[model samples]
Target: MAMQGLLPFLAMVIVQLGYTGMNTTSKLAMDYSNMKPLVLVAYRQIFATFVMIPFAYFLERKTRPKITMSVLFQIFLCSVTGITGNQVLFFVGLQKSSLTIATALTNILPAVTFLLAVISRQESVGIKRITGQAKVIGTLLCVGGAMFLTFYNGPIINIGESKIHWKYASNSGDHSSHHQSNSVLGSLIVIASTISWAVWYIIQAKVSDQFPAPYTSTLLMCFMGSIQCAVIGVCVNHHKSDWSLNSPIRLVASLYAGIVCTALAVFLTSWTIQRKGALYVSIFSPLLLILVAIVGWAILHEKIYVGTIVGSVLIVMGLYAVLWGKDKETKMKTEGISVVMPLEMVEGSKDLELQLPKDSGSNKELIANVEENGTIKSNEDEEKNLGLS
Candidate 1:
């Protein structure tokens, strides 16, 4: 039972690690190999489809639900928001910004999703409740953190130098203004991706309700996303030669992203959601930020700023608050249901007993009849004793 409970956590941890690896490889492909974001997205989806279709086919053959038109429509919508839009924006943003910033910005996802849920009337802001208040405050903190992270770049914290110095430094140095503008743009784009992802969650919930087959849904999303991205890629990049996987880094990035990040990550996430829930999965996102920060510092030799650290702290705190609130709210609701159900059952039993017909007319009349019978027996006993004497 303990291990069963821990399985979801372990799965999510693995997923986050996979995501970290994807970020590293993707950054290398885009920055060093000069792979276009659209082309990367296209390749990612194609690879994911190829890898995931087999699992969806063989594993879910017996139990897979029939995909109706409505299900397909939902899947298409999911593909648009979750796959094509989310990944396209994310890759573009990643190219523009540092890995740490990209990862940190994603911590706002839970807050955004919560706000969306409230707006859509799927969730409530029980302001009178502490949990609800926590959620509201947490959302604000996350938003504030994101804004702070975008605009401010305080003094850089100089960590000890990384031993792995594998970089061709640009000769054209010190373009501070250019980098700043790019960072702002990238942050905004990444934030948009988070919103798209949150929207996907909402739509995917509906899909899960209708379809319930994670692997099949993922395969469909990947397939559709590949087609969508391919069209976009072709129009944007005129150079046919650019699409060639001549570079090892590009090949590795596409393969890793498609197989591990898209197919495996999605499956693991869906499985965790089945065992735990969406909120539970979302809470684990902060782990990615931590992983990215460490990896960026050590491997990429990225500099961390004071503002970045502070903003990241705020985002992490906010993410936890939102998750805690949601978890608390769910538990309270479950407890309330358990409490109300038994009370309702007891009240129903009492009402049933009250409505039952009685054998006796009344308690007072029954007692009086018993007393008169006892008096008659006593008189008979007295007469019998006198005759014997």
Candidate 2:
């Protein structure tokens, strides 16, 4: 039980590490190139598709998606939200605001996901359950923490420069180009990106459900993303005479974002979520703010103001609250339930077998309810067999 519980948390940690590295690297890319946000995002997706295509083929060629016209459309829709909108909005927001704040706001994914799930009738809010209450309260706390991190700022404790220094901040300071106090527009854009991301997760859940193949779904999404981003990149480069390897930083950023953040982190997540659950994979995002803060102060010479500290605490507490609620909910539903990792979705699980607890009378009734509803409505009961390993 102990090891089972730890698995999901561990997955989030791994994902966060890669994500923090990507954030730092992307910032560096902006420093090195005069490339626009669209251009960077376009190239990033192209590389991401290139990287994932061959891997998906080699790893999953036997069960790979058949590439039907309908599946192709799904891939296109996925590319729009998951790849194109998410990266474009995010980099643009980062361009206007601070990465720490961007990370803070983005950590609200679980809450946003929960909210949207409830609205879409994909999940129910068990008001009487302590776990449910905890989840709701935790989500609110996370949001509050994010707001605090962004809006409150008194003292700017100077954290020294990166190994690679940038005169950009100084030049911008002289020009007064960076002040957005929870600036409504910037916040909205980030929120939009978050919504787009939530959409990605929900859709991924469906696609994964249909194909029961995480790698295949990812491959399709990336393949379409490559085409979409390439078109945009060509458009962005139309004005330029020399598009061949202009900026090493852009190339580096695109690779790291594509291969490391998108490809590797994604596979880790699919595996972890299979081992644990989506909620588990999601909660670790808040922690990345701390990682990014450390990186920013150490490498980028960013200021660590009091507000960032306060916000971090709030976010942490709220995240735990949500997790507490989810834990209770899972415990109640655990009898006869098991966390089944679809073998095709994740590797290293083909030989693993779950030992589900014997079903109580209530559990039997619950199963009956699920079957009755299964034929009627499809929703977020991802499986009765989803929990700690």
Candidate 3:
């Protein structure tokens, strides 16, 4: 394949690697470092803040907004939900459950976020068509996958092992490794975290109305989240020596999560959103599950089973269904089939299009190309209705 065509594939691989790496590293750090959840949350925020503050100061110094109360409150709200709440709950959930379940549960986030937005009247479901029904059903299927991973644990063939490692059967003498049974509770915690994250996105959209500098906004969030989680961590882990920054794994994980995952990931994602739009970036992220499964098999040695395969298929199918529905809606709207008028019609109706300039320059004939009856026609070439009434 040509190098240009390979760029998107490489970008996707990198993104999925980042997701799986974050999941695995977080788990390893938690296990080896034996750190409290809130403390890790504090460290993650502190690391992210430390990394972002300098970048913001250097890059956005000329455009930084004056510190306002509303900005501060927005940052505080963002930090509370997105950073502190999301990370703390995810880490706790990961420690309690299988990484597979944690990853899959998170797959329900887009659907959940969309549904919440719709319910809040921030979004609308205008069409009651087959595509719309498919989208809704697909979202439910994604949720069902999460639920199945959490609740169902029967005799399941280890599909990953069957495909990759046929010789090795027992893992450290533990056989009931359909998944870590802790997945049941962990999935619930992560689900809550996902909701919190979706709410954070909602709040962040509101915050964007106040602050134009994305880097500065994210930096402020990290700072506030660090302080908030630090206080909570200290109180929760009182007199516990394990809460200190003595463990190398915890220190590394905190730094990685903060600097790389939070700081860099957010920056790159924001850049992509700015360039290509948010939906363009989001619709591609579900492929991270394949990476997660591979990481779980290779690093964590978590057994993948029939249910995981089936569930994953459902989740992916659901995500695509939602995307398809959205695309169809957009197409209908574009074709002027919806109640909303197209931009051209709106401009033409208001008599605002092709207004003559006041400078008294010679008028130039204008022509607009429009498609009609399977043919492209210039407005000038079309016959006008000139009969007097």
**Most TM-score-accurate candidate:** 1
- Return the TM-score for each candidate structure: 0.79, 0.75, 0.76
In model 1, what are the clashing residue pairs, if there are any? none
**lDDT for each of the candidates?**
0.67, 0.57, 0.58
Off by over 4 Å in 3: 129-131, 159-179, 266-277, 327-389
Ranking by TM-score: 1, 3, 2
Q: In model 2, which regions exceed 4 Å deviation?
A: 1-15, 65-67, 158-184, 233-237, 241-244, 266-283, 334-389
Can you list the residue pairs that collide in candidate 2? 131-325, 162-299, 338-385
Candidate 3 lDDT over residue span 126-215, tens digit each: 456665576588678878877776677567664544233322212311322433656677779988887887676567655654565556
Q: What tens digits encode model 2's per-residue C-alpha lDDT throughout 168-260? A: 434322222343443445555776777786665555545544454444556666666667766776776676622444566667777777676
Prediction 3 TM-score vs. true: 0.76
Candidate 1 lDDT tens digits, 1-389: 99999998899789778878888878777777678999998998888788877877897799888889999999899889887887789888887887889888877876887778778865667777787798899899999999999889799998886676555212101222234469889989989988887777667656755675666777888889899999989999869866989888889999988776655655565566546544566666677788888877777767889989999999888878877775565345222111000001000000110111111112122111112123222212211111100
Better structure of 1 and 2 per lDDT: 1
Q: Which candidate would rank higher by lDDT, 2 or 3?
A: 3
Q: Evaluated with lDDT, which candidate comes out highest?
A: 1
